[model samples]
Target chain A: MTAPVDDPATDERLLSAFLSGDTQAFEVLVLRYRSPLYNLLLRSVRDPQTASDLLQEVFLRVIKRADKFHGSAKFSTWIFTIARNLTIDHARRMQHRRHRSLDVPLGAKEGDAPSANGTLVDRVVGTDVVGERAVDSQEIQRRVAAAVELLPTEQREVFLMRQLQGLAFQDIADVVGVPVNTVKSRMRYALERLQAALADFEDHLEGTR
Target chain B: MSTCEQHQDNLLEFILDELPSAERRALSDHLSECEVCPAVAQRLRRGLALAATLPIEEPPASDTKAIMRAARERSGDASTSVTASTSMLPFAMTGRWGRVRAFLVRPQVVMATVMLLAVAFGAWYVPRRAELGQPPAATMTQPLVVASSGVSAPEEAPAGPDGGEDSAAGGAAQPAPAPPDTAARLERGLQAYGRSDYVAAIDELNAVVSAPDADEVAWTSAMHHLARSYQQNGDCASATRRYEQLFRRSPSYNRSNQAMLEAGTCYRTLGNEARARELLEVAAQDPATREAAQTELQLLGEPPRARRPARQPASRSGAPTAPTPSQRPRHSDAPY
Candidate 1:
């Protein structure tokens, strides 16, 4: 959680505890990172099962080699670097982009802005979770998912890592093995692209009220 | 650093709430005065807020439970069966090839690749000259490598003076290369050590160990290989002394545990059982170097492994203080 960011003892501390033979700290560490790690693999492999399996492999690999982690690096960077290498390995083997059938908007057009009276965005933002609203939420998700899918792989990684994972720019540089400047540039590009894609949705939200 | 154009990008970062407070303050001030930036910032914030409304994709409860259970088991045992709990890494390029690709873009690796080529040539050509009954090119001209600047150790060192050195040789030099720099000399020493030239290695490493010009990094590599050189050259006296100096000066050196281990081995070689046991006990504290120290301890007719907390010493009279069975010096376990 982002709450841990303000805690004096962060991921590195948990890692240190795990390394020093505290098995419980290892549990906390895994729980804390499981979702982000899983989501990263999901986005990369575009398969929940493969992503879940890969997440297991990532933590296992990190644990087996945890004794070798140099404390100088943020544990987040080290773990993400491992995650990235594993994802890259999958990418190399497949030799193609992961398919995202979710990118195609349903019950709506890709470029069409949401309507005030009734639209996918209206149903999602509205306080309803019934039969129709659930479908609406799913559609909104597909649209948002496509927005990320449209991004270049590097830009998407920067976005997922920054916005979702809340990683610092410096740590993202370590994960991607790029200069911090490059990471910042990539994030800027991702934010701009996401902003453009989602602008209509924001306008719809404001217009409805 | 924010120009009007750059501030536009800064506006996006600010809206994401990712900018540092000082930059955030500067941007806030900029937005208040600038005609276009405030509007741009507001739009960006709203757009970002819309994106944030994307629902979180929570992992399956079963998968989370399975993962947490595996983590619990795996953390307890280093050799636990990975198959039951872990999946194989998805990528095939998980080894040296991947690291090589990563290194390709780094300036340090480019310099190192060039140096490795030179070292490879030297390793091939220098010996061929000797075999061909001609003076070695190394003897005629300097084959010095430059000292790389960085803390390269990938694992924790004991709480002591930092004396860590990575096995990879690096540092940029002129096309011809200077032989006098500490890094170059240290590299030359390691090359000699590699070729079984213990005498040459000892001399070169000694120069780095004693020189005022030598930095801590140079001192580490030289001191480590120097002791090995002495031990290999059948001089345990000097090897033990050098190892002792390294132990004292750099308690936190990457090879500090190895220092204790080697010094113990050297003392064992010199028939000094008391000194050997003393150092071996210290080496045994670090899990990294524990097995080797225990092996040597057993070789000296002591218990197989007398594990102890680093702060707690072994029983004063309980330890079997017999001399080593043989006079042979142990080989250093340092990766470099």
Candidate 2:
């Protein structure tokens, strides 16, 4: 998406402006990051509403202590670090409460509520929805999302940063609080597991068409 | 480690196009012939490409606006500690990026942004207004000295330094030539107001304001000084009306925000707390007029709130159910 800001100020500069009492700088920061932040959170939380709340919480914290910005890590890494922690925290809380079986399947909400495992694929390729190609494309997307959601949390986080967020391994390591080598190992494991999980659907790749 | 084992760890980097040139060439050569590594690389590429296809959901649009609104309300009191309840900040925060969390969620950014937009809008609106209100060059610099008791308020007196020490010990110390027409009428009114002659100043400013051929700049200048005349004359009702008109029609008018602040103060003094709160709240939003507005509000004490209607609890049966009030001191290790 095209950013709304002009002058192309660095995040640090924009944040500095926020600290010194330029409120618009902070708005620009919010507009710039809202989408990506939402996606990152939503991709993990698997619920749009919950993800938006997490995104708000992330920036809410940012807004509170706006006077100071960490000088070391880049802003994206720093923000994603916060997001990662919140998502993990929420996930752990839900997990402990549910104590559901692992076989509950990927993409299932952690409640007695109806399973989303079937809804994801069905919503994508439901009957009378669209063309065959569109259905296949949506099918692949649903399948990929499920595969991603199924990865181990550490591996999933590394993969999300690398593929979805486009963070370099070093930066991902910084966000996840791991050594660079550990991050690389996790990314490799993530890819390997995703490939293994979705191997049956590889022939359905949409981009090649 | 075998040739494949050594290059195995490099595959993720290679797929990312992040491998150094030498390592890339080595990986490429090895992958070209190594059966296991070649398939591994293909799967890696396919897996990443598949992951890329997962849709980027557009978050609900209201999310940011809601957060910004919350930020503004939470941060409105600058003196309140922002991080007073950050029990929700994640991680140990022992070192790297520890300090960044505070700023990440502060409301001041949005507050500052609102101020910036207001200033920008004011900046854009003022020149347009000036273009709209253009008058002859001769009449533009006409000044009206505020009755400041010998303290010069240049903002009230745009006139060139004319002549004479302020005659009164407590008069505003501004001098200007005695001229005729709109400028003269405005000057006469100002002189009267400065001399504490409210009745004559009101009559003179009223005639000048009602004049058919008044210059646009002179009209604005007249209305502004007329409000001052009314305020000094202790006619706060008329003063507030004039100030509110100027505030709505031409917020860029000199001391327009000041007018609002003053109007709010006047209304508050006259036992109209609601109007005072409204005007003071708006004035407090502007950086230039913030201190004045906030000071007035502090003086006004807490604004009265409307009483909420009593809520009846819903019961499936036709019996009345008393609602439980959860009002209590909250203790938690999490930030809301």
Candidate 3:
């Protein structure tokens, strides 16, 4: 991903300069980090509108608490930590609301609200309607989403942050508040289960050949 | 740990393309040596490749910019209000003055003032008569002879030997001063300045600054050091003024660039933003002047102004120069 292009040193320097009374240095810092931070949050939270809202909240917190970024870790790590914590808090709130509402179970909800999951990908891909093509691409994506959802929560988080979000394993450990080995183990178990679940399709392809 | 478990775990991250380079190499080596690990590694890699290809969609590009702009605007507002809150600080300090004035305006301060006046009057007026043994409303005190009645006493004296005599009559003794050798004094002043005795240097330099026939070198150098002395003494205001004088009078002095930077910093420290920016911008555009200017302007949130190459003053030659203003370098902006 071209390493996301926001130089950690430069970001920290801008932050330090801002704290030292150069307010405008912060503008460049904000402009530079916004996109990567937005992408990270969107992928984690999985809701575009909510992710957009939380992205603003993250930057607002960044500016207000700029002095607290003491360069103890790489600036990227610190920023992602902020994003991670905010994402978790947001998810917890969402979970509480969802539980209180006591809505339908997963597969039924998926069937009824095809537009919710399927349309998001279709709209993003800008193709014909998601329902028009239930072929390999859509089926594969649906299976991948289901497989990821099926993982234990901690394993899912570790997998998302590590593989999809491109955070280092150490950072995943920090984000999830576990030992690095524990994160690795969860990822191992998660990957094994996914591989097993997709074995039928692999075997069916072998048979067709 | 069991070999099967370890191999399986390594296969997971290796398949996902998430293993670090060193670990990936190690896993590759392990797969080549361990027969059973290959099947596991292959299956995991294939499965992960399939998962990766499942095409997780990104948010639309239009949304990216829109969201970021909204984020920036929100944060900007938050920071602006924080800045506004800081601006209220001076007013809070001034609030104490109002409270102090209110207390003073109460009847208590006036009553104390009256009481003080009464005690002072009794001590002075009532004691004077007894101390002098003068009584009753005594006859005519002849008009006190005021010196040189028609002329004004010239408020003290003009600050010289004659002034000292007038001062002596008012109850202090006077000392004679030696004649000053302007040339010798200036020479010694430069020497003292070179040795860093700025106190003696300023004393010597002051004589040269005021001398009627002072050479430009001596006058400029003296002013520069006088400014430096004031700066070293923590009198930044005086130092800044002297530096301004040095630059204005001798703009091509060896230290003029340094002086300009220092003067800009002093103006900034004193909260004169416009003047500080003006000087810093000029300094920042010159190749010779950029470093110091860089530090100052980085803290000011302002960019340096474009600088024209040095031109001979038209006043000196009475002819317009060939290089037009538009030919000058454009302002180079540094990142905030």
- Residue-by-residue lDDT tens digits, candidate 3, B119-168: 99888877787886776353122111111110111222111101112222
- Which 10 consecutive positions of candidate 3 chain A have the poorest summed lDDT? A98-107
How many angstroms is residue A7 displaced in model 3 relative to the true structure, after the best TM-score fit? 5.8
Predicted complex 1: CAPRI docking category: incorrect
Would you estimate the TM-scores of all the predictions?
Answer: 0.46, 0.48, 0.41
DockQ values for all predictions?
0.09, 0.12, 0.04
Instruction: Give the DockQ of candidate 1.
Output: 0.09
Error of 1 at B307 (Å): 68
What tens digits encode model 3's per-residue C-alpha lDDT throughout A71-93?
76656556666666676556545
Error of 1 at B332 (Å): 28
What is the Å distance of residue A122 in model 2 from its true position?
A: 10
Candidate 3 segments exceeding 4 Å error: A1-3, A6-10, A17-45, A100-139, A197-209, B12-29, B33-35, B54-336
Model 2: number of backbone collisions: 23
**Tens digits of lDDT, candidate 2, B10-70:** 8878988889999999999988887677767777787776777776677776776666654
Higher-DockQ candidate of 1 and 3:
1
> lDDT of model 3 at residue B3?
56
Q: Note the chain A TM-score of all models in turn.
A: 0.75, 0.78, 0.63
Clashing pairs for model 1 are A89-B91, A90-B91, B160-B251, B160-B252, B161-B251, B161-B252, B163-B253
